[model samples]
Target: MSPRKKIVQAAFEKKKLNGVVARVGLVLDISGSMRNLYLNGTVQEVVERILAVASKFDDNQTLDVWIYDNEFSRLPSVKENGIENYVAKQILNNETLHKFGRNNEPLVMEDVIRKYTKEEPSTQPAFIVFINDGGVVKPTKKVIVESSTLPIFWQFVGIGNSDFELLRKLDEMEGRFVDNANFFHLDDISAISDENLYDHLLHEFPEWLQAVKSKGLVL
Candidate 1:
């Protein structure tokens, strides 16, 4: 085997996933559309799995949860949520711009950008997972464009049948676009299973992670 393969094997033997991580910033679409049961579970199921898996990374990583909508634009900030807030503000910006409430208080995309441009932070390494139904309002594009430049690494997963085409397109050109790769996916939840989710996440997560780190970002 190659020397690199030998080294990795030895590392695995020693149970060292040093650079490989577990904690992550999970963003799910709690919009009205998510309630449309696409599979055995709604998009919520995926978020649950994400949280569960993060727990396994206890030694190396932690998972933070953030949900978005108008009245509930954020699911308690990750900062206050107790996990590292490296990407909290960026997620908040994307949340406000790229999301509308399922019920109340709509904050336009410009609002998020106007806020972010005024304050930029160090780009941290993070598994920015976006679970959305591409049904956001049109004007939100401004928010998307503005905040899109913020994240250093991402895992954009689209749930349901919302124009996967458009959703994938709005993503950064060099952005963390997963194009159905393991880290990223276009899931029709109705036809999926937990096992399927677990296996894919396990198999695909590592490589996408490697790609993100290759860019020289820190999580």
Candidate 2:
């Protein structure tokens, strides 16, 4: 059996999955920077990546997604929610970061983590794939402090010229994976071709998933 199959089984027996339910959450970044021609448009790149991953799962599996910049962006434009639609809608509108009452935007990774744990207690092994072209905008400590108690696995991929050292530092930590914690830092979008991008996603997904599973998560 596949790793995903094994995990679904183990998590079912343990009754720790959030929603008793959806096995995954793909949190994508639809920030202003993704509008550039980095990857056949940011939305296309992300949508394609997600679809590929999802295609590998069992037919019965379900996954939820959220795109964030200023506020949380949902997917599907009268269509299946994925990288493609999200990119076209959010990117074209250029409102990826339209937050209210805030002079500056904050990274929602920590908040999303807490919300998942609280709103969907049955959702286990809540994996958050945080994509960004900028900094978290919130303090590193705040990200951890604001996170939920649920065990969240983070996969962060940063684009653009922003400082990615911090994101890298978080992923490499030896302790428990915290609220703002994640897996990668692909800072220079200009450098990553389609092959490079897809390969990174394919390679990292298994490694991180396995490592997290080895730690014995409920999922």
Which candidate wins on TM-score?
2
Model 1 whole-model lDDT (C-alpha atoms)? 0.45
> How well does model 2 score by local distance difference test?
0.50
- Write down the TM-score of every candidate: 0.52, 0.60
The runs of at least 3 residues in candidate 2 whose Cα sits more than 4 Å from the true structure, single-residue gaps closed, are: 1-22, 37-40, 57-63, 76-86, 90-107, 145-149, 171-180, 187-199, 202-219
Q: Write the per-residue lDDT of candidate 1 for residues 1-219, one digit (tens) a residue.
A: 544334433443344444454445566665656544422244444544565455444334355555566643335423323433333344433534444347221252333233223443434434445566654555444444434344323455666556655445543433323312223455574466555554544554465455545544335
Supply candidate 1's per-residue lDDT for 120.
34
At residue 93, give the lDDT of candidate 1: 39
After the best TM-score superposition of candidate 2, give how far the Cα of residue 179 lies from its true spot, in angstroms: 10
Error in Å for residue 194 of model 1: 3.1
User: What's the alpha carbon RMSD for model 1?
Assistant: 9.5
